[model samples]
Target: MDNLGMVFGLTGAAIAALFAGIGSAVGVGIAGQAAAGATSEKPDLFGKVLVLQLLPGTQGIYGLLIAFITLSRIGIMGGQAPTTVQGLLYLAACLPMGFVGLGSGIHQGKASVAAINLVSKKEDQFGKAMIFPAMVETYAILALLISILSIFGIK
Candidate 1:
């Protein structure tokens, strides 16, 4: 029972890393399929498509960062363990990043697929195409910011 707080904190860290990683994997897989098809037709577009395919991956990194921070904060990485209330607070703080990363990564992937198609058809529009998927990244960034702020704010 004394270690319950540590368990909760660890769960929070796992949730942050796991959900975001799953989202990124799915997003990258979807975008990779589209990118492969596009590049098959025009190898020169590889660079452009690759960039779009990787855009959704940022959320996973953000999630990982949150997890690391949470772990460190709670002393899982090496310090005093948190109380149950503090552990719960950490869990709550991680939620935004987990949920938002999941949704945004998937949507961003779809957006990247569309952008890939657009670029495949009109190579000159690469700049404009990049914007579509990049827009989805905003929510993930916002969630990351909130998670970071919340975690650090927790005493």
Candidate 2:
């Protein structure tokens, strides 16, 4: 039973890292394709496109933070195993960041692709174009805040 609690805690941590990494990979890959295509034609837009491509990557970092916090809280990093209920709470705590990061990262990637195309076509519209993807980042940030708060709130 005690071992099972640790298992649940570890599982939550792994899920946080795994799902978030997948999301970031998908998002970065999608955005990178668009960035490459845009930069090929308008090499001067490299900096702007590169930034857009990197936007989705932040979700992965957020996920990693959640995982680290979960591990520390659960004693996985070097402490006593959590009780079953505590372990379950930790698992629940990781859910928001993992799920939201996945969704937001992919959506942000799509937004970045659109922004990249817009900037490629209208260089002067770069500021406005950046707004779309930047907007997507707000959701990821929100999820991160919620996940962090949840983890911290768990005694």
Maximum-TM-score candidate: 1
Expressed as tens digits, the lDDT of each residue in 56-126 for candidate 1 is: 99989999999999888787787679989888888989999998999989999999999999999999999
Taking the tens digit of each residue's C-alpha lDDT, what string does model 2 give over 1-155? 65777788888888778888788899999999999999899899899999889989998998999899888877778666888987888788788788888898899889999989898888989889888988988888887898788878877
Best by lDDT: 1
Single out the weakest 10-residue window by summed lDDT for candidate 2: 71-80
The residue ranges of model 1 lying beyond 4 angstroms of the native Cα positions read: none
lDDT of 1: 0.91
* Candidate 2 runs further than 4 Å off: none
